[model samples]
Every structure is written in C-alpha cells, then in structure tokens.
Target: MEKQTSANKPHIMTIPYPYQGHMNPMLQFSKRLASKGVQITILATNDVKTSKLAHTSSINIEYISYEIEQGDEIPKSVAAGLGYVNHKVLKRVPGIIEKHKASGSPIKVIVYDSLIHGALELAHKLGLRGASLFTQTCAVCSVYYHVQRGSLALPLEGHTVSLPSIPVLEIEDLPSLVQAHDRLYPGLLEVIKKQFVDLEKAEWIFFNVFDKLEEEIAKWLSSQWPIKTIGPSIPSMFLDKRLPDDRDYGLNLFKPDAEACIKWLSAKATGSVVYVSFGSVANLAQNHMDELAWGLLNSNINFLWVVRETEQNKLPGNFKAEASEKGLVVSWCPQLEVLAHKAVGSFMTHCGWNSTLEALSLGMPMLVMPQWADQTTNAKYVVDVWQTGVWVKARDKEIFTREDITNRIKDVMDGAKGEELRVNAIKWKEQAVEAMSEGGSSDKNIDEFISKVISTTT
Candidate 1:
C-alpha cells in the first residue's frame, strides 16, 4: 500500500454531462475514489440546482459549481437540451481549469462524461491527462465505436445488424436519436458521432458495468483502448461495505417523496405492489399517460408510479379519484429504497440502465418499455439475454394501448411465466452482490483503477 502526501495524492476533477442520470454515476464513482484516499472535485452546471458542497467524514470530496447561460424558451426534447448544455460547458472549460489551477489544487487528470467531447481538446491545451467515463452499458459503447469505424451505418432504420459480441438487433431496437422524425435526432446523432472521435483522443475510458454482464463486449473494447469495468455504480448501502454513515450520492435534482411512499408500501402485502418510473429524461404524451393510468387501474393491483412534477397535469381527468384506492402517484420517490421493500414484486420501467440495474439487484421482475436512446438496447438485454423481464411493444411505433399494459402486468404478476422470471431475477441479484463483494470482478477493477491513478501521479 502507498502512503499519501498532499503534493503527491491524486487530485481528480470529474465532470458529468449535466443531467440526473449522468451525474449520479459520476458522483458515485468519485465517492468510491475518495474513500480510497484520492481527492475529488465534482463539477456541476449552474443551470440545474445542486448542493454547493458535499463532504464525507474524511472531507476529501468537494463540489464546485459553474454556470451555463440559458435561453428564455426551453428546448422541447431531451436531446436538444443536452446539446445546449454540452455546448455551454465546452465554452467554459478552459477558464474553469485555469481558475482551479490558480487556487493551488491543480487538477492532475480530468474524468469527463463521454457526451462532453470538448473536454479532450481542453485537456490537450492544458497538458493534463483526460479519461472518459461512459455512464451507459458496455454494449452501447461497442455499438457506437463500430458506427464510428464505418462498420455500422446511421439512420439504420429497417435494417438488422449483428455485432461481434452483442445480440442481433433490428433498427427499431437502436436508439431513437438516429430517427429522422425525432425532433433532436440530427443534433443527437452528431453528438454521438463526435463522441467516438474524441474517444480516440482520451488517455483511457471507463464503463459503468461489470465484466460478467458484458464479457464479450468488454473484451472487444479493450482491444481498442485502455478500458476498465468499475460499475453497477450503485450506492454503497445497496452493495459495497462502507462506513455506516456514507449513504447517498447527494446529487438528486428532484427531491424525493420518500416518507409517503414508504408508509404506503409498509401497509401493502409482500410481493404485491408494482413500481413504475420512466427515469428523469423521458417524457410521455398525454394519450400515452392516459393509457398507462387506465392500464394500471384496470389490472386492479396496487402500484406506485412516479410522474414528474411538470407532467402531472397530463394525467387523465379524475385519474386520482379513480385509482386512489389501488394506486399511489408521486412526483418522485427514493427509488432504491422503494424497490428494496418486500412489498415490491415487479417493476414497470423505461429500461434506463440505472433503473434496470436497481430492479435486477433487488431481484424484482420488470415490464420493460423503453422510450429512447440506449434504453431500447437495455430493454433488449432485459428480455432476451437476462430473461428476467418482458418487453412491451407500442402499436404502430407510437402508443401502446391500455389493454397492452394491463395484460403485460398481469402476465408477469400472475402466471407460471411470472414465477420463472422471479427466479431469474433472484439469480441475477445474487450475481450482482457477488460482483461487488471484496474479491469479485467489479471490486478488483476499482482497486486496479485506484492503483493505476496513484502510480501515474507518483
């Protein structure tokens, strides 16, 4: 083991892409590094309100805020908003780095989210090492790399492509970013394409996944660049052994309605409640919301659904009155806590990687309904590879009916099929736990990453 000194200790600056999903994983990784004696500075965008500072008992971790000017009119889609933020962040990077360097804690390395490609150029200007932290699954990264290599084509609509390590996927299974009809399609596609360009310039790349889950893809990616698998980037409370007091990522953009949801779950029967959430970015049309509400009501089962505060008005009229007896709706809830509850038997999700991992780690079966981006790919893995969940198809590639939702929920919660899924979910949960344990693959990978950082600085 190496002893640390103020001058030689690895001081890392980590910047996520200014979104909830991206920020959570980056923050978790920073905490894990801080626990190992590294000093970490987390950079957050001013557009979103976040805690100015977060300190562990050791006080090695700190948060710094930077501002990105916003226009009066908001962007209508997630991809557009991401593009806006990414551009703003790039413009401010050089100044942000200079200011930090003048303050005496010069950054030795920068670990940036893959979406912010401009960081690589900034790193070059400052003569600092740069690494990319991809918050999505390894499979998506492999796919994107091939697309950059000219092996796969964009606007791959109505075509089936097979990759070396991943399952064969239809164009429909690809991210919605490539669709011409998507409002943000062109901007999002360009961003992803440029990401691979900047990826080649990074000193190393890190994936928020484990080797066992994407063994083939992980091996393939290593041939291209220095890569490490250091994830299932969950809270320490859920998987790793940590100080009793080190509990949250403390980076949530939305305040959780944890107490109310927990009380409702306490009154329900074990394995009887359905947990529904679409993650932080996706938005549902009013018709789709109506269908979802009616479907949950029609099933006559207890459900806890999370609708964003902005979208609450989109719910069907009298929905609260009609479903109050059986369903509980909240703007947001403490998801991991809710899923870990014994009362949660199944999940209805948008198949975001974070949400997917949380449900699998808790041994809960899922009804996967992916909306856009890497979520479609995640849905494919949930249904075909893991066999721990069922996929719900939308009619005419638009909206799925209320009946479709009802039947999917009933099939997973009532039939022999449901029992098999439950067994598989429990098996994956055990595997995840084993991976995060002391000698497991994820644990070793993190240790290796820390050692590499220390050696480089020394």
Candidate 2:
C-alpha cells in the first residue's frame, strides 16, 4: 500500500514497548484514530518490522522501524528489556521526528505506552503534545500513581493495603515489581518512578478500558489527570463494534496453530475444555511446569494448552503421550478464537490485561494464575471485584502445588460456585459488548479523543 500524505490532517506518532500485549492495543488505538482520518506513524523495533506475524491494514497508519542494539542479547525479563528499549527509543526520537518533518507530516502529538516515560519528555522538548496510553487497567495505573505520590508504600507483602475509591488488596496482590528484594526490582522501580513523573507531565492519559467497566476507578483517576477511556481495544471481528470492514487487530507475534486447535475444540462438548496459556512473556519454573502437567492430567478434564516452543522440553517425560487422550498441546493457538469457542468453558491464564479482556468479552470464566507486572492486580480484580473467576494462590507464598491447581480449576469449572462464576462471566461479556457498540462509552471516548487530536493539531 502507498503511504498517504496530508499535511492538514493531524499526524500522531505512537511508540509501544516492543511486545505482543503492548503492540496489540496500541495498534488498535492507531487504527481507530486512522479510521477518523488521522495520520498515524507507529514506531516499532526492527524485529517487529521483519516478523511476518505482525500485520495491520490501516491505510493511514505507517510503521517506522529502528534497530535495537544488543538485539539478540536483550534480557528475557520484561523489566530489564523495558529499560533497555526506553533508553534506545529516547535517543532515536529526534531522528525519527526529523524524518517525519522532512516528509511534511510533522508529528503534532505522541501517544506512548506508559512504561516508556522518556518519550513524553522528548515530546515536550519537540513542542508536541504527549499522551500516556496505559495498556493496563485503571486500577493498576492508580496504584502506580499513589506510589509516586508517596501515598502508598511498596514491599507490603505481608500486609493488606487500602486505597481511596478502590478495593482493599493485600500487598501480595500488587504488581510483583514492587517487591524491593527481586533482582529486577531496583531497575523496574526506577522505570515506574520515572513513569509517574512523566505521567504527571503528560497532557492526557488514555487507558485501554471503558468507563462502565471500571466506573469508580476511572472517575477517581479522572479527578487527578486529563483522562479518557477508549478501549476494550479488541478485534472488531470478536466484538463487532467497530467499522464494518475492520476485523482482526492484526498484531500476532506468534504464528497460530488455528486449524488444529479449532478442530480439537469442535470435538469437545460445550463448556468442557479448560484453556491454558501464560501469555508471550512469562516463563514457568521447571517444578511448576511438572506440577501443572500432573495437575491437568490428574484433573480428568479436556484441555487445550499453549506452551511456547522454547519451553516445550520442560514438560514431564511421556507427558504428551499420556495426556494426548484428553488434551491438545500446541506451540501457539489463535487465543481470541479459542476463547470464543463454545468448547472453552474456563481459562487458566496469567491474567494479562489483553487476556483478561478477551476472556471477559467472550464470557469465559477464568482460573487466574498471574505471574508478574499488572497480572497480579488483574487476578485480584477477577476474583474479588468481578466474581467471574478464581485465583490460584501460591502455597506458603513460594510454591503452588499441583493439588491447588487442580482444585482451583475444578472450583471454577464444576459445581455451584462454577455456575455462579459462569453467570457473572456472561454478565461481564454483555457489558463489554455494550461498551464497544455504537454510541457506547468506548465509542464515544474514541470519538472525543479524535476530535481533541484534530482540534489541537489544527
């Protein structure tokens, strides 16, 4: 496709931390803006630019690539990688902005992922408006805001904490990065601390959530910043709420084993299969993997599991052969499609925001096993706020036993409690759909955001 050039139109640049979860929502947001005739330039790493899995068809959205130094040697930890990328991107912004200006579509504003705080400062230096696009929920953002304000203390693992206008949460339910003792904590904490500082400086803060979904929290947050809710940022195919031709989000980092997984799901009874995935980033310990395999096999449930190719060898020996009778394991499966299937009754997930929104949108109850970052908070919301799923708590704050996993899965997929969770899941699904539909909260917010961009740029 040819690049469209229109100097009069508002030109917005988006920079998402280079990951599937961060890229997906930011891409969707760009698509929504492009649909409204805005010129969008999405800055991505060289890896995403070359990967065949990353796809999008918005005519107004252009992708600019930058080389990540130490590309192959970048650490696997999200916190470490985030810091590295933020540093690289901060240096590249001036050059990128100059290239766009040379093309006569000078960037009028920047929409940056919350993790990359340096971008906001750069935007100010360039005389461009900067908006913080939080890919996580408002509750997590609020917690971070409080942390920056010194209203909340971190490393409260053994204590319960309460925040104004939010639910009471144990310190354990907070983002794991706040644990001062973890190896990545110091760097991650510094990133977050800087983020809060930049967030206060940003002109607007956008969340990938709708007002109705988290009304109280959103309202409370809006009181503090110029905030907008323009999301559920899911594929139009799944939600059927966006423009008619808009379908997939088109941001897949992994090739999906779609046909095989769908065929397996087709053979299962409705609400009978337990779908498990820990998302793209989180890694499981070897002992935890063994316990998970045993737990799933011993539970006597039909399951579809997505284990990454790199981690497949960690599974117990002969495990696939024995579990093949009732389970299907693939390197990756089309998650949105799988969750929307009638066969998928409950999900055993890492509670990433994207995964959580997908499950809620499809009315699929969850068995949340959050790993790190915003996941623990998402799990807390799932079990306590929404009542649509059960959380798997680590035994003695260190290990999660196979029995605990089995019991939690059963609790959400079998009895009276399971039925209630299912009903609640369906309720959330309906609410999500309504929020995305025409004239709904998310739709209105997007329209308003586009209007603001156009007005400010003009």
Candidate 3:
C-alpha cells in the first residue's frame, strides 16, 4: 500500500515499549487515529516484526531492529530491551523522521508508550510534538504517581491504604511491585518510576481508559497532568462498530486456534462456558497450575483455557486427556472473539489491564486471579469497585487451592449474586460502547487530539 502522508493530514509515529501487551493497545489506538483520517505508522521493536498484523490494515507498522540478550528474570530482560532502544533505536529515529519528511508526510507528533520516556527527549530534540500513551488504568497510575512524589511511602505500612480519588486499598490491592519493592524486581520498579518523571514535558498525555469508568480518579489525575482518557482502546467492532471491518485487533503475537475454539463454543449452550486466560506473559507455578486444573475439573463447568506452550508442561499429567470431555485447552485462542461468544459465561483472567478492559467491553463477568504489576490493583477494582466479578483469593503461601477456585466459579456462575454480576457487567459494557461511539467521551478526546495535531502542524 502507498503511504498516505501530506502537510494537512498530521502524520504521527506511535511507538510502544515493544511487548505484546504494550504493542496491542498502541496498535488499537493507531487504528482509531487512522479511521479519523490521521496518518499513523506504528514503530515496533525487532521482536514484533513477526506479529501477524494483517497486510490489509489501514495503519502502517515499521520495525526498529535491535538485539539484546534475554535475562533470566522478566524485569532484567525488559531493562536490557529498553537499554538497547536508548543506545541503538534512538540513533535511527532521526533518519526515519527525515525520510518521512522527504516523502511529504513529515512526522509531526511522536505518541509513545509512557514507559519509554526517552522518546520525549527525542521528540524535543527533533522539535516534534510528543504524546504519552499510558496503557494502565488511572487507578494504577495514580498509585505510581503518589509513589513518584513520595506521597505514598514505600514498603507499605498498614493493612489498608487510602489515596485521593481511589477507594481504600488493602495491602493486596496495591501493585505487587509496591507491596514488595524491596523483594521484587527493582529494574521494573525503576522503569515505572520514570514514566511520571518527565511527563509534564509532553504535548499530550493519553490513557487507555474511559472517563465514566474512573471519573473521580481521571478527574484528579488530569488536574495534575494533561491526561485524556481515550479508551477502552479496543477494536471498534466490539464497541461501536464504527470501523466495520475491525473485528480483531489486527495483530497477534500468538497464533490463535480460532476455528477449534469457535467450533467448541458454538456447541455449548449460551452462557455455559468459562473462558480462562492469564494473558501472554503471566506464568503460573506448577503447584498453582495443578490446583487450578483440578479446580476446573471439580467445578463441572464447560471451560476454554489458554495455556501458553511454555507453561503447558506445568499442567498435571493426563490433565488434557482427563479434561477433554468438558474443557478445550489451546496454546492461544482469539480472546476477543472468545469473550464475545454467547457460550462464554464468564472470564477467569489474571486481570491484566488489556484483558480486564476487553472483558468489560464484551460484557463478560470476571473471576480475577491477579499475579503482579497493576493486576493486583485491577483485580481489586474488578471485585469491589466494578462489582463485575468474584475474586479467587490465594490462601497462605500464595497457594490457590482447588476449593478456592471451585467456590469462586460457583459464585460467578450459579446464583443470584452471579446474576447481579452479569447485570453490572452489562452496565459497564454499555458505558464502554458509549465511550467509543461517535461524540462519546473517548471519541471526543480523539477528535480533540486530532484537531490539536493538525492545528499545530498547519
């Protein structure tokens, strides 16, 4: 396809932090901008060069090739990737910017993942507009903001904590990074800290959230920063159907077993299946995995579980053979499609921000079992704030017994409380639709962002 760039179109480069969870939201946002007649080119790292973003997608995706050794730990590996970008990819961005200029689509704005704060410096040197796109919820970011300001002391003190615009949070409600700052990965903690450091320098700040979803917190956060909640950053087809063909996210890091999963779901009665996924990155321990497997078996409910290839080994021996009658296990299935399916009664997830938003968008009740990062905060909101799902708590030593899982599944699937959860899920789902529809809160923000970019460019 030919490049659609001109002086009037406001060409922008969207750069994510180069992980699947990070890249997916940026790509969805890029699609939204492209629909609004903005010229969008997504900048990705070498790892994403293999992502199956359709060739027919309206947005253009370009890769920055750089290599670094992967460390044993997630935080150290992420840090190394960021270091490579600082040393290698940053050097090449100027040439790419100049090339776009030569092609008559000069890059006017750099909308980057908040984690890669160096992009703001690069934008300043190039005299281009910079926008920070935050992928997490305002609530989670609020906690981090307080941490950055030292308003919320580290190695947390009490049983419960309170902050402005957020409900009182238990020790477990805070992000794991905050809960165990001294014990957990410091590199990731440092990276999260940098997101808020030079944030005031950016021309725009976009959060992948919707106003009504976090009105109080969004209001409070925006008063301090130029925060715009232009999200539920999901595909239009699931929300408003504004972009008719935007059925999937247009990019997938894991090849989904779409046909098999869909065929299985099609046979189940409506609202009969539990759709389980811990997202692309989270890994469950062997004991936890075994317990979860047996829990699902005991629940006696139809379920579809996405166990990444690497993590499948942790499943109990003969678990697959044993579960074949009531469950469908695949490495990955099209999550959005699965969630939207009539047979999927509820979602059992790690409460990753993207997965949480997707379930909300699709009106699926949740069974949140958060592992780390913002997930803990998200799970808190899921159970208490949103009233959409039941939480499956881990017992002593973080062991999620089969009993805990079975009981929670029953709570979400079989009673008056379950019906109430479904009602709340539908309410939030409608709000999400309104936010993405024409003239809605998130749509209005996108329009404002476009107008600002064009006005500055002209």
- Predictions in order: lDDT: 0.79, 0.81, 0.87
Tens digit per residue, CA lDDT, model 2, 1-458: 11224645778888887788998898778877777677778887556654432454553334444444564566666567777687777877788789889977788898999888678889999988899898989898888778877787655545777887889887777877764434665466666766678466888789998776799999988888888888888877677555765566565778889999999999999989999999998899999999999999888999999999999999998999999998999999889889989999899999999999989888989998888888989999998999998867652457777898888888877878899998998898888888778788887777777677776777
The alpha-carbon lDDT assigned to residue 230 of candidate 2 equals 84
Q: Report how far residue 453 has shifted in candidate 1, in Å.
A: 1.9
The superposed Cα distance between candidate 3 and the true structure at residue 422, in angstroms, equals: 0.3
TM-score of predicted model 2? 0.91
Q: List ranges where model 1 is wrong by over 4 Å.
A: 1-8, 46-84, 91-104, 179-184, 394-398
Error of 3 at 380 (Å): 0.3
- Report the candidate with higher lDDT, 2 versus 3: 3
TM-score rank, highest first?
Answer: 3, 2, 1
Instruction: Using lDDT as the measure, name the better of candidate 1 and candidate 2.
Output: 2
**lDDT, ranked from best to worst:** 3, 2, 1
Clashing pairs in 2: none
Candidate 1 colliding pairs:
none
Against the true structure, candidate 3 has what lDDT? 0.87
On residues 176-227, what C-alpha lDDT tens digit does candidate 1 reach at each position? 6644434656456666767778576787788888777788889988888888
